[model samples]
Target: MDQFRSFDQLRTNELSVLRHGFFKLWFELTDGQFCYGKLSYGNFWKTIYILEVEKKTWIIKRKGIFKRSFLINDLDGMNLGVVTPEIWSRKIRLSMNNGFEAVYLNKKLISRTFTLTNDQFGDILNIRTELWGFKKPFKISFDLDMLKKIPELPLLALLGVNLVLIKQAKAANAAS
Candidate 1:
């Protein structure tokens, strides 16, 4: 699959993360669709398990507790590959099984990137991958006019962003 076209929908007018309770988060599309995830502890240490809103499918399994590393899978539970953070370079690199490398550029102001699937590209969230003042919640923006669609790519992209932010928070906490 072409890297560029695979994640063309990652950016749009409507994507937001809503907190239902502590550790219970839902990816809310302005069109009333929802994708949900829960933060858990176990063999994976800190694992993020995501469910697509439409089919209630577990599309993402992020298994890195002490670091921002993940092996993202597809619908059939096959490994798509991993996303590792290059903090020194301010980028998240997605390494796919087919030897496709896509970069998610992380900057203080704006960060943008894409994820890949087997046949086609998928969801994109228009978000800034940075945390603000202490104790402030993270924020994401979605194109409200885009309408509702499948939740696979959005969930993938969201999981990737969460991993990056969580790693940054951990580092900061460790430093202090």
Candidate 2:
């Protein structure tokens, strides 16, 4: 287990989310030097994900059998937040119990870029997919000031990558 003290210690505002293996869903949040966090499957079915940041862990899983939303829960089973997708749209809303809310939406209808924004901070983070990898790695750039405002910024970044993966899976399903 990596001891991630804080994102403030990072030397750069930009980081990359890279897959761990050729066929694995595990990903690491790194700035090419220090690892800030990680995101990996919690179960074999791929319905649950384990997010680790700052030596703390959280589980992200589907809300129910018929629901499209996912729940974020602490190790003690306390619900911390929820990620809900908008109907007939490409936007996803994330709400935390601490009264924090943000929306992740594509930069354009047909683009690979996505931005995470809230009413107060506007655009806090930008995530772009790399075009040259089978794993579809992502590059994330965030505002350190805005990150200081949102304590869950790192977890949300991991969730943003999850959302992109879900969107791609849906698109592939629709095409086939």
Candidate 3:
């Protein structure tokens, strides 16, 4: 539905609803690859996955394996669920809450500029350390192409830790 707005468009519209979620969409045309990282509204992070369409499969680099397949070939093997093909633009919103969001795309989820209004500039600043152990906390971002190796695929490890930090804040706030 055209009425379904792009995440970027939604940001421009400036709808306020406490917080919202975004679809995970990242593509590096230079490398001919596509990836997805979802963070639900105020929820924790979800593992990102890359599609190996040439092979007709999606794969995730196993943790502790370091760039190795954590699952066997045909990761889903039919049970993994259907792989739906749709075309549309994609935009992601990263809020101060720090969580994984998964939104369905009406289109291909390719390129769309989305904006996120964060209520906490200082909270993000404050949680920087607890989120990223390094002395400097990485900025809250929905970036997809900041890679460490081979065309700088998304900055995953760092992003993951940041999710942890965000979740902690949510948990603490709930307790309070």
Candidate 4:
């Protein structure tokens, strides 16, 4: 993967995701290209594998007796961060050793929390993240040629975070 441009450099306002269901999704770019991924669930573990080009790579996974959290790891298997769900609050929190922390909330009709960081490159819920959510659905399509150019980690972050969000939401809905 290429060195990521700062969060400020990417035109995040142009990013969009089309969730096919709870397990399948497509991340669409402003130029009409898409990165796709799938969520695999098991009794004691869950994993998300995203196809950056033609190869499916493990982005994040949750495994154990409780399965309360997910771990993000690099290609070398070094832990990059952790994403845990606040079951009672129905929130997904991503925390990294490097001081990045974010809280994701449920999607609303007009205010879908898609992506974007605050001025300090902080969490999406912070007051400084401009509108802090999507104004409308992104145009959905696929162009495989564009996938190689898309930075991988950012897309991983998008897929993993939203996967956690969707799981929490579904669990909350089921509880009710």
Candidate with top lDDT is: 2
lDDT of 1 by residue, 44-142 (tens): 434555434333334444555576677766668887678787766766676767665555554344433332222233323445433542222344554
Best-performing candidate as measured by TM-score? 2
TM-score, each model?
0.53, 0.94, 0.21, 0.51
Candidates sorted by lDDT, descending order? 2, 1, 4, 3
User: How high is the CA lDDT of each candidate model?
Assistant: 0.47, 0.86, 0.27, 0.44
Least well predicted 10-residue stretch by lDDT in candidate 2: 1-10
Q: Write the per-residue lDDT of candidate 4 for residues 53-160, one digit (tens) a residue.
A: 223244566645569787766556677678787878745666766765665554453443433232343333211112333432332222233234333434444544
Tens digits of per-residue lDDT for model 3, 1-176: 12222222211211111112236323211111221222122212334444332223334333343432122123554333221212343322231112322222212333221222223221111111223323322223333322211121122222333333334466698999
Better TM-score candidate (2, 3)? 2
lDDT of 3 at 41: 26
- Alpha carbon deviation, residue 1, candidate 3 (Å): 16
Please write out the lDDT profile of model 2 over residues 1-176, one tens digit for every residue. 55664787877888998788655668888888778888889877789999898868899999998999999999999999999999998889999999999999996878878899889888989889988865538999987786678877888888898888888888899999
Q: Which stretches of candidate 2 lie over 4 Å from their true place?
A: 3-5
lDDT value for model 1: 0.47
In angstroms, the error of model 4 at 140 is: 12
* Worst ten in a row by lDDT for model 1: 1-10
Candidate 1 segments exceeding 4 Å error: 1-12, 23-44, 56-68, 97-101, 109-125, 129-152
Reference-based TM-score, model 1 = 0.53
In candidate 3, stretches whose alpha carbon ends up further than 4 angstroms from where it belongs are 1-37, 41-162, 165-175
